[model samples]
Target chain A: MRIVALAGGIGGARFLRGLLAVTPSSEITVIGNTGDDISLYGLRVCPDLDTVMYTLGGGINEEQGWGRQKESYVVKEELAAYGVEPQWFGLGDRDFATHIVRTQMIDAGYPLSAVTEALCARWEPGVRLIPMSDDRTETHVVISDEQGRRAVHFQEWWVRLRASVPAEQIILVGADEAKPAPGVLQAIADADVVILPPSNPVVSIGTILQIKGIREALEAKTVVGVSPIVGGAPVRGMADACLTAIGVDTTAQAVLELYGSPLMDGWLVAEEDAGTALDGVLVEARPLIMHDVESAGAIAQAALDLATEIAARRGTAPQGEDAR
Target chain B: MRIVALAGGIGGARFLRGLLAVTPSSEITVIGNTGDDISLYGLRVCPDLDTVMYTLGGGINEEQGWGRQKESYVVKEELAAYGVEPQWFGLGDRDFATHIVRTQMIDAGYPLSAVTEALCARWEPGVRLIPMSDDRTETHVVISDEQGRRAVHFQEWWVRLRASVPAEQIILVGADEAKPAPGVLQAIADADVVILPPSNPVVSIGTILQIKGIREALEAKTVVGVSPIVGGAPVRGMADACLTAIGVDTTAQAVLELYGSPLMDGWLVAEEDAGTALDGVLVEARPLIMHDVESAGAIAQAALDLATEIAARRGTAPQGEDAR
Candidate 1:
């Protein structure tokens, strides 16, 4: 089946790794969330896209789950030496090259979509990895600081503040005017199963949905979303912070309800959130923590199985697709 | 005492190391030429500045005069994966970070001079290294190619073509309208002596002179120049090709004459070309080959001593003041 997975960083990359192992990579298209993308030292850095790319390309340091392994921090040191702003996110000497190339290409008139494609050609992530849009859609977190209430860049709120402050607003700036990247909507429409990994529901998955027509495309398909919340807490990262900002409690039920039955035909939660169920949606609980490649594969297989079973029950048959 | 020394690449870097060893660094200011500067993957790359910086900051590759040692090519490999243009100039992964920071800073409203200062903060090349100007002054060479009478970037002409095709004309684009970088005129005007390194006479030091007021400043000072031409050939690089392009013989006398007595108080050549003096310029020919650190230091000391003697002859006078 043609599998299209929408993803974020860390959790998203780990889950995608399992998804790739579970099926043939050729059949996959990962529409990576770029809302957290930032321009540092003039270079475009898509943390989520890089996470996915590095994870699949075998360049990832399993321990770090972020930058390249054995990474040198010469660039960051030089940047610091220059007294640059936002000295939180560490761009290493080796990693800086990727951002540099991406930034240079973007400056040379290539949009993020084209640049991502160009970057992915080297990693050959097996699955086609694309940004949700070429538009400059940045996720800014509004926090009350001593100065006043203001929105900081996603990274500033993330790395600098460590997301300690209550998120006054989780704004996906530029999404109102943004269009989904080419083939994004089409992939969602043609997907036998549209899977949302346990990525941050607000800033990650939510950011993708904010892109025009993506939610509608998923709504039209046998969409399945894996809950980021397990046992009333995110498996990793600050997912709950965004959840609370949107007036949703950090619960499996609350998150699923936010996605709603209209957008999801199947909702999979961790086995620990056992009592949860949806009236019209197929609910299957499994051990959803992507602790390792095999565990992630099992979770991915379960999501695919849920979609397959739902498609079979509806008396609808999905086309055979690549597993990548 | 005032000291001026010529330089190019690792040899120049080595020589500069010796110059720093022998002289007070606070008074030193480098007038680096941008003729060898190239745009690799859309990011501006200045080789001379990097050489000077890396050497001074103790980051220079002891083996390779150019580029960092233990560098990775993942970035270049990845760039090729995107089918990026300008594959001739080598930009290693570590080397790339330098360019990226510069490009980013420059794009973010920092002038080239300011960007150089920012970069120098990291490398801390003892001397204040100033570019000819902040303007995009590119060196292009007119040559007979496949189509005949075409102009190519200085890099392509120097590196890729290897200057095989005879150059018909050499022009510094934007030189006419370009002003000297900040502190450049002041450094030159206030200097007791200015030395042109044994760099390419036409491209390296020659390009620096092309900037407005640089030649005038040099003419107004006790200026000294070292010839790249040695033993009827260039000391290093394709200086002979550059010389042929400009219709000059590859000889120390020719290069000294090319610079002319109007701008020269002293001229230093390799021992093979020693004792060849001009009408009004003091000449010294010494062993200029930088075999090792010791020899390089010796060469630097020789250049400095020459400038000191010239300064003494000029009565250690300040500019705009009567020696009487």
Candidate 2:
């Protein structure tokens, strides 16, 4: 079946890999979150897009669940030696090539979506990957510290500070002006099911939803979301801190409620949160921990099954417009 | 005595190191060639200036006479993997950082000279190093190949082709509009002597002279040049191909005559070329090979001594305007 998935970085990428395993690669379309995109050393770096690309492309560091495998930090080390600032972010030599190619393309006037398409030509990540918006939309976190209250780039808040500083607010700098990247709405409108992989609710899936027409388009579809939080904790990464930044509880129920019935038709929670319910949404609880491809695929299959069930219950068909 | 030197890449950098060994770095000012600079993968790569910087800063790949020591090519390999064009150039991972920082600064509106100074802050390359022009002046070579007669970047000709293809002509694209960098003219006017290292005469020192005011400034100073060509051939590199492209003979006598009396007060040549002569210009023959630091230092001393001798014969003092 044709599917559309919203993704963030590691967790989202991991979940998408499982989705790819359970479904035909050609049927999948990923709307990657560009809110965390950053310009480092004049090169545009999209963490979420690269994570998904590398993960699916089989170049990811399996141990860290992010970045390239067999990576070297020669470039980063040399930059430090030259006394260039923002030395905290870990950019490996192999990883730098992606940003270099991406930045070069963007500077040459191609949109981010086109650049992503070109990069995917090399990775051949199997599925179609497109950024949420081609327009600049960097996520910034407001925090008060010894330097007083100031807003810093999301990467600085997350990678540099390691989310140590409590984020008072999480802001999408250019969300209002950003149009959903070309094909984003059409993908959502044409999908048999829209899957929200176990990505961060606040910054990953939530950020993609913030784009003008995306949420409105997904709201009319059979959208199934697999909760990132299991047993009141994130499956991976510091999703808890991100949720706290937006005043959301670190629980599957609260997150589902935040998504609500209009945008979500099915919610997949862990067995620990079995009683989680929504007024008009179907909730299913099962083993959500993705230890390997098999477990993750099972979860993906369950989400798709729920999406199919929800569509059947509403007397609607789970198929794209062309298929219908 | 305050000294000013015109330089290019490998040969010039080696000569500068030798010059540094004999004279205090604080007494020297180097006008580096920027005509061979090229933008690779959207990052500005100043081969000549970097060569001088790395050589003097002790970060140079000693055996290769360029790039960083203990360099890795992970970035280059990855760039090739992504199918980025112009992969023929050898830019190491460590070298990539330098370009990244440089490109970032250039994009941020800093002049090339200022950026070089900032880069030097870390290298602390002893002597004051300045580009010949703050303005861009890339050298392009016209060659007739299967692609027909077309102008390719000087780097493509030198590094990629190894100058195997005959260049019909070598053009400094922006030289006519290029002005001497801020301190270039002042350095020339304030010099006790101006030494031309055994850099590529047709490209390096010659390109620097092509900048609007630099040649005029040096014409009024005590200038002594070490002939890059010795005994009918270049001491090293493809200087002969560059010379031939300009319809000049690759010989000590020919190169000195190309510079003429107004530009050259003295010319140093190899022992084999004992009969090398130019009217109104003193020609001296010696061992011009820079086998090591000590030998290179000896050559630098000989050039300085010749400049002093030329000034003495002219009944003028070998000192700057202020000293006089």
Candidate 3:
């Protein structure tokens, strides 16, 4: 099956690992969010794309859920010694190499999308990992801090203040003009199944959806999205703070409603939240916790199986993509 | 007093270490040769400058005589996994980070000299480390391989081939038109004493002299030279092959004659080659073997003292150049 996954970081990468484990290697395509990408020490660092790449390429720090394993800190120390400002984000030595090569390609007149492909050529992330856009699209969180209204880079919001303050708005800087990177829209259209892993709704899926034709492609696919908010709490990271910034309550129903029918066809929530009413959606409640790789594999299968069940019941399965 | 030293790689770095140990840190300036620099994976890597910086900053690998200590190679394996070519050069994970940042800066319109200064700001290599020029000036070696005539990059000639083949010619590509980097001429003009370390004559010191007006500035200064070859053998590396390529025999007198008259007010030779006659040169022979920091410190001080002695004897000594 040609399965295309829309992923963010950590949670998304972990779930993709499970999906890759369950499916054939050549069968998957990952549309990675570049919203969390940042220029650090003049390096273009795409955390979400790297997370997916490293996790799949066997270089990820399994314990930390970020950066490469057996990574060193010499670079950070050297940079720190140089008195560089904003030393919040941890760019481990091994991880820095990825950013360096990516930045070099980007500097060499290749767009981020092409740079992503070149980097993937090194990691081979198994499945193709396509950035949502070749164009520069940064996520800016507008917050009313002590210094008044201002938009901070996504990394500053995420890593610097740890997303402590409330945000008035979250804007994808260049999304309106950004075309979906090559293979992104086609992957969605040609896929037997399209999955939105339990990635951040606001920054991850939301960022990808902001790309010109991504939502349109999703509307045309047999799409299923797992709720990032389980039991009204994020599984990890500061997702809740971001959700709160947009005045959205952290809940399975809220998340499904947030994505709406334009993207999510069949919504999957935890079994604990079974019978939960999600308007205008076919909701399936399953054991959603990744648990372990095997359990995650089972959950992935369940999501795929649910898409099939939802598609069949709607009676528009093969006839039309709209009903499903 | 300000001091400018012409340097190459490991030997240059070791001598620089000694220079810093003997002289006041603020009074020293290093004109690092970029001939050994290479662009691996599109990142401009100035290996010699980094060596000098790392060595003086206490970040260098004292044992390996190059690169950062406590280095890792997770990135290279990742690069190889992706099928990157030129697998011979070992770009350690930590070292890769430096190249990445440098490439980023260079991409962002920062000339390498400024980038070197910026990098030095962090390492505080104590002395200013200026690239001989910001322009492209690569060293190429012409060798008669099985394929007949071929000119390879300096790194390929030095590291890949180990200079095992007979190098017929040593060419500094773009040296004819290359201008001295921003601080290079200034350092030379303001220098109290200039010392040529026992680095590779063709690839290191020879490359530095190729920069426009650098040699002219050296001729105006009270300069002391150290012969890289001792008892007709290179102190380290493939200096003999390089010497042979230029058709200069590996001897103290021949090496001194390569610098000729005005560029050398004095020359330091090893005790073994003390009796070797060098015309129009004030010569000092000493135990140049750097067995430890103390021994290296002695040799460095000897070079500076020789320069000072020559300056004192030269009718009128240059003021504002004492590195006390």
- 1 or 3, greater by lDDT: 3
TM-scores vs. true structure, each candidate: 0.88, 0.97, 0.89
What's the best-to-worst order under DockQ? 2, 1, 3
Q: Which runs of model 1 end up more than 4 angstroms from their true locations? A: A22-26, A69-74, A81-85, A145-148, A321-324, B1-16, B68-74, B77-88, B92-94, B143-149, B161-168, B285-324
Winner on lDDT (1 vs 2): 2
Q: Say which docking band candidate 3 falls in.
A: acceptable
Model 2: docking quality category: high
Clashing pairs in 1: A1-A321, A24-A323, A24-A324, A25-A324, A26-A324, A27-A322, A27-A324, B6-B196, B6-B197, B7-B197
Tens digit per residue, CA lDDT, model 3, A180-200: 888888888888778999999
User: What do the candidate models score in CA lDDT, each in turn?
Assistant: 0.81, 0.91, 0.82
Assess each model's interface with DockQ, reporting 2 decimals per model: 0.43, 0.90, 0.39
Model 2 misplaced regions, further than 4 Å: A320-324, B319-324
Worst-scoring 10-residue span by lDDT in model 2 chain A: A315-324
For model 1, residues A256-317, the per-residue Cα lDDT tens digits are 88888788898889888877877778999888888799999889888888888888889886
lDDT string for model 1 (B164-267, tens) is 88888899988899898888888776676677777788877788878888888788877766667788988777888888888888999999988887888778
